[model samples]
Target chain A: AQSVTQPDIHITVSEGASLELRCNYSYGATPYLFWYVQSPGQGLQLLLKYFSGDTLVQGIKGFEAEFKRSQSSFNLRKPSVHWSDAAEYFCAVGKGNQGGKLIFGQGTELSVKP
Target chain B: DTAVSQTPKYLVTQMGNDKSIKCEQNLGHDTMYWYKQDSKKFLKIMFSYNNKELIINETVPNRFSPKSPDKAHLNLHINSLELGDSAVYFCASMGAGRGEQYFGPGTRLTVT
Candidate 1:
């Protein structure tokens, strides 16, 4: 079965520090990868996705993710973390022909310190 | 404007009661889905509909039924709600071939 794993359960970083959230997926074929962020009591917002070409994909709110096929990983990163960036991040994997069916990771909670 | 919207942002209900959550998308997407987030914040796909046809149905209980009146609307009806059913339910929509989905503000269901 296809699955996604987010190793870090919770991470804390300073407001101005850089951030990297790790993600790994298990799928037979080349998969569609996505990153999403959810604030407390709020719905998820799509940060970025990797489907076909570009390994490095940029998304909303200055978020970027790099998809590495060799490691079966898609890691989200930010140059500078803001206080408002504190949220739960999820990594998901989807099959090529599967319609909107996504297997999501457990989620990583980010806490930004001042 | 909201791309995808769900009704009853918060719902507190007693066990054994039946309730329904409605979802609609204005993005004209042909595919819609329902996901459940547990108290631990683990997300899982429950059901999916494409062009008003059921495409994917996970290992959800039979008490939970999904209805898609049209391509733009999908509703989930739960019968005999149990305490274990307390979780946040999210609605999402996607284009025909695109894997990217637009999510709605989730409905937090608390079964007391």
Candidate 2:
């Protein structure tokens, strides 16, 4: 079974501070990894994804994630956080083909303090 | 225009009643999916339709049915809804090349 784990339940960070949300997955193969952000009452928006090639991938809103196969992790990072980035972040794993169901982790809520 | 969309942004109904939620994708994607997000924001996949074919159906209850009329539309119908079904339902579509999925605004279902 392919599953994802996001350890932090909630994280508070200061604005303009670096942010990193850790994610780990267990799968049979080199799984397809993704990060998604969801605001209150809004649906999820893709932050980034890792399939093949480079270990690091950039996404919208100046977010990026690095895929570390040895650690079985794909952690999301942002050099400087903003208040707008205060939302719930989810880590997901796919079956690695073009179209497969994605299993999401328990989300981590992010709060930014000015 | 919205890439993916769902109808009845808000649905309030009594327990034991039946309801249907419709989803559409104009991005010419071949795959569509349905996910449920609980009050605590725990998300899980319910069903997936690829090219109008039922591809993945998780351990969803038989009362929850999904219909795909075409490659661009996927609808979910829940029968005899329970209070636990009160959550936000999202519709998503994934293109062939793009590993990312685009989600709709979501339909909030309230079963009272």
Candidate 3:
């Protein structure tokens, strides 16, 4: 069975501080990884994705993720957190083939302090 | 322009009622999906449609049905909804066999 694990349930960071959200996956082969963000009462927005080739990928809103094959993890990071960055973040894994269903992790709620 | 959109951003209904949530994507993608986010905030895939064909159907209850009129639209219908059905539903689309999925603003369904 394939699954995703986001270790942190909730994380708080100061508005100008750096942030990191950890994610790990269980899969037999190389898996496509993604990070999505959701605002309160809104649908998810794709932050970034890692299919192959590059281990590090940059995304919108100044977000980035690094896929570590050895650890089966794809962690999301931001150099400087903003007030609007306070939202829920989800990590997902999908098979490399076409038409693969996404298995999502329990999201991490981010709280930015002033 | 919104890549994907779902109607009725909020829905509140009584138990045992039947309701439908419609989704449309203007991105000309070949695949669309429906996901359910439970109270615990666990997002799970319920259905996936590719080129109007059912590609992925997660072990969802039979009371839930997904209908795709075309490659661009996928609608979910729930019959005899139960209290456990209260959750936010999201519609997403992507190019076939791709990992990047564009999600629509979810529809929060509250079954009282």
Candidate 4:
């Protein structure tokens, strides 16, 4: 079974600081990975996705993630995070050509302090 | 215009009552999906439809049924609801063979 693991349940960071959200996955083969953000009472918005080539993938809201096969990790990063970036982040894994059925992680809640 | 929308943003109903949540998308996507987020914020896929055809059906109980009248609309109906059924349900749509999904604002169901 394909599964996603987001180690952090809650993280607090000062405004304008660098942010890194860790994500790891376990799958039999190379999996399609994605990161999504959700605000209270709102639907999830895609942050970024990793399909193939170019291990470093850039996404909306100035976020980027690097897919590392050796580490089995795809961690989301942003050089500077604004207070508005505080939200729940989810890491998901899916099989290629499988109609995009995603297996999501428990999610990590980010808290930004001004 | 909302890319994906779900009706009845908030639903408060008594136990044993039946209810339905409707979803619509205007993105011209060929596939639609339903997901449930529990109290702990763990999301689980419930059902999926592609072009009004059932594609993926999770381990959800038979009390829950999904209907897709057309490619752009998918509705979820629950019968004899229980307190355990209370959760936030989301509707999402994506293009065929594409991983990008557009999600609806979700409906929070509360069972009393």
Q: Against the true structure, whose TM-score is highest?
A: 1
Candidate 1 deviates by what RMSD? Answer: 0.7
Q: After superposition, how far is residue A78 of candidate 3 from its true place, in Å?
A: 0.8
lDDT of candidate 3 over A1-114, digit per residue (tens): 788999999999999999999999998788889999999988898899998898999999999999998899999999999999999999999873747788999999999999
lDDT (Cα, 0-100) at B59 in candidate 1? 90
- Chain B alone vs. reference chain B, TM-score for every model: 0.99, 0.98, 0.97, 0.98
Window of ten residues with lowest summed lDDT in model 1 chain B = B93-102
TM-scores for all candidates: the values are 0.98, 0.97, 0.97, 0.98
Candidate 2: which docking quality band?
medium
lDDT of 3 by residue, B1-112 (tens): 9889999899999999999999999998998999999999999999999899998888999999999999999999999999999999999998865678899998999999
Instruction: Give candidate 2's iRMS in Å, 1 decimal.
Output: 1.4
Instruction: Judge candidate 1 against the unseen true structure and give its global Cα lDDT, from 0 to 1.
Output: 0.95
Best by lDDT: 1
Task: Give the poorly placed runs of model 4, Cα more than 4 Å off.
Answer: none
lDDT-sorted candidate list, best first: 1, 4, 3, 2
* Model 3 global lDDT (CA atoms, 0 to 1): 0.93
DockQ of 4: 0.68
- For candidate 1, lDDT tens digit of each residue in B1-112? 9999999999999999999999999999999999999999999999999999999999999999999999999999999999999999999999987889989999999999
Per-residue error (Å), model 3, residue A27: 0.9
Per-prediction share of native contacts kept:
0.81, 0.69, 0.88, 0.48
Query: How well docked is model 2, in DockQ terms?
Result: 0.73
Which candidate would rank higher by lDDT, 3 or 4? 4
